[model samples]
Target: MTNHPHASSDAANALAALAAAPAAELEHILSEVCSSPAWAAAVAAARPWSDRQALLAANRAAMAGLTVADLNDAMAGHARIGKPKAGDATSEREQAGIQGVDTALLDELHEANAAYEAKFGHVFLICATGRTAATMLAALRERFPHDAATEAEIVRGELRKINDIRLGRLLGDTA
Candidate 1:
C-alpha cells in the first residue's frame, strides 16, 4: 500500500522501536491497538515486519483466526459510541463526532446503546472515526435486528476496521 504523504519520521522511529522491542513490550504496545492478547502475541511473533503492509497483513491474519472469546476480550477495551472513556485521547478522537452535538441526540444515543447491549449482550462497537453521532445511532438501530451469527461476523469486521485505524495512527500510515 502507498504511504501517506504526511507519514512522519516518528512512524519510522516507532516501527524500528517496535521491531527491536522485547516480546513482552511489543505485545503490550499491540494490546493497546487491539486488546486481544492472542492477537497481540500472534502479531508480535511475526515481528520485524518489512513494511506497514506486512504488519497490516499479519494483523489481518491474526484477526481472521480470533475465536468468540478473543473478540470479547478485544471488545472489552472499547467504550460505547456516545460514551468514550474519560481521559483517553484515542477514544476521544475516535468518537469525536459525538462532541458538540445536540444533548437530546446524545441522550437518545445513550438509551439506544443500553437497548443494544441488552439485545446483543455486548457493547455496540463501530469504527467511529469520522461518523456523526446521528449516523452511528442509525447504524446501531439498523444492525440491532441481526441474528447472533450475523452480528458476530459484523463485530469482527468492525474490530478489524478499528484495529487498522489504530495501527495506522500508531505507524503514521493514514490507512
Candidate 2:
C-alpha cells in the first residue's frame, strides 16, 4: 500500500511519533483509530513499526485476533450507518455521500438500522466513505437475511475495511 502523495508533513511526523510513543499513549492513539481497547493495546505493544504498511499489517492481524466480545466493543464506537452525529468529524466525513438525502431514504435507513441491530445486537457497520445513501441502504437490505454467524463474519470484514481507511486517514491520506 502506497502512502497518499498529498499526505501532510504533520501526518508523517505523527506516524514517526506513534512508532516511539509509550504504551499508554500509543494505545490511546490506536483507540482513536478503532476504539477496541484490546486491539489498541495489542497494536501498540507491537509498535516501532518500520513504516505505514507494517503498521497496517499489524493492525489487521490484531483485529483478526480479537474475540467476538472485542469485535462487539469495537462496533460500539461507530455511529449507525447513515446517521452521522453532530461534531463527530470522522463519521461526518465518512458518511458525507449520504448527506442531503431525502427524508424517505433516511427513514428507510433508520428502520433498517434498527432491524439490523435487533438481529445482531450491534450497529450496522460499513465503510461508508464514497458510497451514496441508496447504496448503503441496499447493502443493508441485502445483508438482512444473513445467518447470525454469517453476519458476524461480515461485520468483521467491514471493520477491517474501516480500520484500513481510518489508518490511512490518520497518516493524512486524503484519497
Q: What is the lDDT of residue 45 in candidate 2?
A: 70
lDDT of 1 at 141: 93
Per-candidate TM-scores read 0.91, 0.91
Candidate with maximal lDDT? 1
Off by over 4 Å in 1: 1-10, 173-175
Per-residue lDDT tens digits for candidate 2, residues 55-78, read 888888988888899998899889
How many residue pairs clash in each candidate at the backbone level?
A: 0, 0
lDDT to native, each model: 0.88, 0.85
RMSD after Cα superposition, model 2: 2.3
lDDT accuracy of residue 30 in candidate 2 = 81
Error of 2 at 23 (Å): 1.8
